[model samples]
Target: MCVCTNRFLRLLIEKLCLPTYCLVDCDPYGFDILTTYRFGSMQMAYDAKQLRCPEVCWLGVFPSDSEKYCLPQQCFLPLTAEDKKKAEAMLNRCYLQREVPRWRLELELMLQRGVKFEIEALSVHSLSFLSKEYITSKIQGGVRI
Candidate 1:
């Protein structure tokens, strides 16, 4: 949300043609944040081209990750009515269907499963597990989407 940071990042990405990755919680708000980074805010439509990071990749804390990583039961949080509604609404967005159908399917799967988790949930294993294993493996293995 910091304009300075976004401007700096945008300049860096432009000059270097950097590949960007986004890691957010597996929740509607988190998803919104990721989209904001990739698509830019509707409020700032005037400067979207300067701010948006089109090459950004979704990096972690996907919904299916709960079962895949075997996060403890304590880490799973049931989606509220608001959460379900938000996810369902997002599912209808054309960008998801056209540009990232796999991402949309994962979002749909999240709604069907009725659960959410945070990046911190990965810490249930250990701090190093994220940097050393999950992130390293996902990036190296090209599993990020």
Candidate 2:
């Protein structure tokens, strides 16, 4: 985790008392980053409780979004062998099952789809597609799992 992200998370969770939402690529590495934000990394396990943001929720660029929003097929990338291995390892983490099983399901869906896409892919429609449309629609429709 970057020190800036850690500091910002701390500020958001501790000082602001606000819920955090993550918007990341629909891929193994992105899922890992989400887990780190919610559960804290093992390397810093000793301070996990304070660093972890239990109120954080995953907000989009889900595998299903490719079809939902009509994003161009060219924007999607095939998952590599390393992506699969990392995703499988993440699927086995106890915290996922115990704390947020819904998130695990999404990861499983990504593996099943065997594809990944960046948030920027939404820009295929327009520059503000992500902020002005995709995110607004998802939030308004209660799409977050």
Candidate 3:
């Protein structure tokens, strides 16, 4: 593959046919970040086809991952009214329903559970858990969506 330089991320990744993975928190905001990376923002809707990266995959930390990784109960924070509102609005996005139903379902599960956690929550096990274990295992085991 050629050096990427400052080329548009989506175009560069597509040109190189690179495998992309997005690791974000289990919160609504993190999900928004992931979707923005995949679909571009509403403000950029006009340029979406050229800027979007449809191949990018969700890597974590999923709501279910809290249980899978054995995070303690205290690490979870109850979703605030604002968080609930954001999540509810995201669930209505047509692209989520049409293109990534699994992701939409995860968000639904997060809302139903009424809790969210940051990526740092994995540190409860150990600081190294995120890079050395969680991300490594997720990719190696094909656990990402």
Candidate 4:
């Protein structure tokens, strides 16, 4: 489950009925990874719906969370040209507009801010900060979609 490859996830989705929650870095690549998990990749277009876990919701490390959680400024990294290109391509995906508008908004915010951070950024305060506080609070607070 750590990786979001469509072939493997297709099998997992077919066999499981549980909800899936995605926790990824607050970056274009990470956002793309989440999209792949929930929407499947174009390369696997024929099986996209079957592979996609539409029930999957993004659990953060969102760009906005860096400020919300007071993560160190040093943890934020500027988006490279390649990151911007990837994000722009993702922005054009039709499923984003039709299915996950809120997630799309978050991706837009990341592009607007031009910055990204890793899940490990939450650990600036403490090694267990993500597990003990971030993830727990986001889940309990119903902060996914």
lDDT of each: 0.84, 0.86, 0.86, 0.83
Task: Give me candidate 2's TM-score against the actual structure.
Answer: 0.91
Model 4 poorest 10 in a row by lDDT: 1-10
**What's the candidate order when arranged by decreasing lDDT?**
3, 2, 1, 4
For model 4, the stretches where C-alpha displacement exceeds 4 angstroms are 1-16
Candidates in order, TM-scores: namely: 0.91, 0.91, 0.91, 0.89
Instruction: Give lDDT tens digits, candidate 3, residues 19-126.
Output: 889999899999998898788777767866766678889999899887788888899999999999999999989999999998998999999999999999999989
Q: In candidate 3, what residue range of length 10 has the lowest lDDT sum?
A: 1-10
Where in model 2 is the C-alpha error above 4 Å? none
RMSD score of candidate 2 (Å): 1.5
Candidate 2 local lDDT, 18-137, one digit each (tens)? 867789999998888888988898789988877777777888778877888897889989999999999999999998999888888888999998889999998999999889988888
Candidate 4, residues 81-135, lDDT tens digits: the string is: 9999999999999989899888888889999989889999888989998899888
**Clash pairs detected, candidate 4:** none
| Cα RMSD, each candidate | 1.4, 1.5, 3.7, 2.4
**Cα lDDT, model 3, residue 131:** 91
